[model samples]
Target: MKPRFPIPLLVPLLLSVALAADDDFSFDFITHGPMLGEVTDSTVKVWARSQRPGEYAVRYGTDPASLDQVSAPLKTTIEHDNTGWVTLTGLKPETTYHYQVYHDTLPTGPAGGFRTLPNAEEHREPEHNPRGLFNFSFQFGSCANQNPNHGIGPSLPTHATMRRTLPGKALFSIMNGDFIYEEHRTLPVTNWLSQVGLTPGESPEIVKLAPSVVGLWENYKTYLSRGVNLAAWQRNMPTVFTFDDHELVNDIRGAGTTGFRERRAVFRDIGIRAWEDYAGWACPRATSQGIHFGTAKLEEGSDILTDKDADFSKIDLAQAANLHVHWGTDSAGVDDIRLDAESPANPNAGVYDVLEVLDAHRLRVTPAAVADSTGSYSIGRRSHGKFTVSNCDFFLLDCKTHRQMHDPKEPGKKGLTLLGDRQKAWLLEEMEKSGADFFFVVSSVNFMIPHNGAGGHEFAEGKDEAWTSMLDERERLIDAFDALRKPVFILTADLHNSFAIKITDRVWEFASGPLNSVNHVPKNDEGDRPATGLFRSGPRTCDIRWSSYILPDLERLQRLYPYYCVAQINNVFNMPKELGGTRWVAYPNPQVIFQYFDGRTGAFQYAEAIGTERKP
Candidate 1:
């Protein structure tokens, strides 16, 4: 200033300062690894995503060094809102290939790599696929919360470690649910941002983002950034993900009209957006548009509201006043007033319809909603639409959507329902028609019986009785499997513990412990008897094996009677504090091999000529 520098020199100095400022701007570009899908002899589906939006490209080859040899261009698309995902196809089976994804423009940012699954048909020989051989080795877990103080944040590092340790071997990983803890706003996002050293004012772009979605996106980003271990895993492996309660508001009933419906709707939109962004691509257009209810049957004499009839714009002042008086007010007073004033003879037959015009308008505006009250059930043709993945039929059941009356006297809670009659029929039909070898039923909550508490282990208390009411349906579904006798394995992760249960005519169940949480095995002296009497009699009726790995601290395993193994990883010896974590000990892996068992004696004394392969 004193020297009065030339205008050209001043311009250069300003430009350099601006460049430096831009360079100092801190942002995160977390990547979710390559997930395998649509596997076949010739090709398989490989997908990946990053936090930031940009052109995504994938380069692949058998050799890690020469990934350029089999490089393929990929198109990144938006799913929920901000998460960027890409899928690569036409990969050969049983081949090892390395892949790297780079932003089209921000080339300087991080680029990760992953491998694909083998061709299912290629493993013809026993040697090639040994005993207990699985075509794929996948690691799936759920119930991860964002804990910044722990450094792992919301996502589990052990799963990532397992993926990295396995390297080119892991086919895929499934994040069953609770991918983020956004809905529970007890932990403020601002606090999280502060922990991450992010100033709120610096990133004005995030201000426009929805709180739930922002929380989820931030948690995901934090995992990617803080997950130095997970980054290594993602660079080598891909993950397939699904949402549970935490993804949206916890325990949301999609079709129900509870007070939280509006909040749930918002949560669903934001959750799906965050899911599409952080996870791989999900085509939820059908779900998003509420098209799944097209085939839903209505209960007789029920008021079925439709988008057109219940449209906010359609309600005139009189119609709105009538609705407010009838539905908005208490039901008790209306029944008495209508009985005494309108119909003196029949008190029970209270004001069923406020106005014939409303009913007629409902019929014209929303025929589906009108038909819903008719008691005649409808079953829409089972179509996967966009949510289906090849070789796997995902029955993402709507267990939490409907509210059913519950009885308190039942062993478990009486309110839970596995499926309404219509959904049950559709599910059976789908199962019967399914061509895939494995049917992966993704339920947010546990489908199997709970061991800890009776009365269905209240996840949402009074509002969640519908989930507990379906014991009969659960048994019926199990019976269907017993009748069809097809190979079926159910994956659920709401219990915060990992378990593998073998459900047959004879109850042969095996449960795994939680990867996180406190490890507490029921001591024999504690007298926590087995629920199905499978523990006392022997391993015949059920072979239940439970294990828990509480990182950097403990690991324990317990089998019913003949064998129980427990191992704890403590820093007692000359081991590093970080790697001193313990893992549960067990002789046989808990995977069911479809063997015969003695229900009466609880014994597996006979051997069958069945081809059982281990899951690698």
Candidate 2:
């Protein structure tokens, strides 16, 4: 197949980076990344892919000159897409460490550095230790669709803007999905005029299908190699990832893509495998084994798994529980109780031999209490997770993997779910127990504010992609968040424009626009219109305090300025008692400032401060 975009210029440009004299190591150098992954107190994972099969290592230290530490050389193979991670361990906490990737004795790319988060030992009561609660910011955005043949350019200017604007201040970035739109060899008729300067097969980049990993790897490399800004930012900052639909297929569900229902399992398995090798390895997961069991309950004294909304057909029975199964709490803090299902003794409450999958929804297993039996019912892996830095906690939800196909007709269906059972339970439990002052929940899709109108608007005919589709589950999750009473900010993307909706007194949803994709303006009948209490979805029944969009008009929307959001936690501000009052007092209240910046010009566009209450 043809290359996704014209990349002939990129080939020699990347090839020139390997300056070492050795023919074996110099020629086969780093292709895509030195992308920083999870940066803990004492360790950091650096992900890189070679141009070909080779061994690589990371040389690092707090001082760039000395560079004493070196990671164990990891080999990159075509089987794993020639990508591997080199973890630098035994580093000091809260210290900045500079590092460079090496193909044997040769330097692959320019040196990049990242600062580790404060250690757990540094966390203490603010009253006892003044410096215990540290303040920091993080950059986040989604839908960096790099379909170069389309109207969008190969250069992801947003990434460059994010790196230059935020510099080294932002702790990390959360690339909440749609990192790549795996659509190759497809172009629009309108975009045909834009392809005049490009030649077919101009670059050596090949698109191979069958194995799926090859094409996906090519897709990542195509995008990464095309954009210098994206590659540069990735190399410098540590990024946590959670995928949306595009990583697998456009608007994919658990069942499958609408037309290709038969290939659901293959798509999910291959998509996730490629994602794991490229993205998921960076952050840890709460449930990293199989798909978390959904609709777990005791029906008439029998343990039954009936998730009517989910498509169990997508489960790979081969690499499933039969190989190995683990049960217990969904918390990332606790170790899962591993059970050998292949054992003849059937020690796992008779789960080895007689585990019956009735259909897409219903399954029969050994009878047990609902709380005691929390394991994956299908082939699910690391999709959702919980992580913490200083005083802020993060919950990254996997919106696509366990998602049910949303029906526009029945918006309030009983079983329609966005986050499946075990994940929801874990999120609620973790939120309740969290001691952090701020919570940043990463949901790749939008939380509320239905993009499609509720009534019979022409544009709203079959749209049910956002939280509006799963009203019941969304409300329940919101209520759980409301009960926390702390400042909970839901960071979301997938929508092509940036907006913020104050969902409740303590809960807010801040969605950033696409990093490089076209800026999509919602229709006239779409989004929340504050003038009337009614929105496109319905009456604004929820306690939404305020709502605002960065590009509210078509004129500004046409500018196509890429966007990203930065949330500054534990910020202080002064405010007045009355509306637009001059007699102001020092608020000194702990707050989170949601700041938006234009990805093209790096200009600060908007800012909103939440959590101004005097007490926690």
| Top candidate (lDDT) | 2
Best by TM-score: 2
User: What is the C-alpha lDDT profile of model 1 across 57-151, one tens digit per residue?
Assistant: 66666676666633355444332323443445666655666655554433323444445554333332333222212334444455555453312
TM-score of 1: 0.58
**lDDT score for candidate 2 against the true structure:** 0.63
Off by over 4 Å in 1: 1-52, 69-81, 104-113, 120-134, 146-157, 182-211, 251-269, 280-426, 435-440, 451-469, 500-502, 506-513, 519-616
When summed lDDT is taken over every stretch of 10 residues in candidate 2, the lowest stretch is 328-337
Residue 507 error, candidate 2, Å: 1.0
lDDT of 2 at 475: 83
How far in Å is the alpha carbon of 218 misplaced in model 2?
Answer: 0.9
TM-score of every candidate relative to the true structure: 0.58, 0.72
**Cα misplacement distance, residue 164 of candidate 2 (Å):** 1.3
Candidate 1's error at 391, in angstroms? 7.8
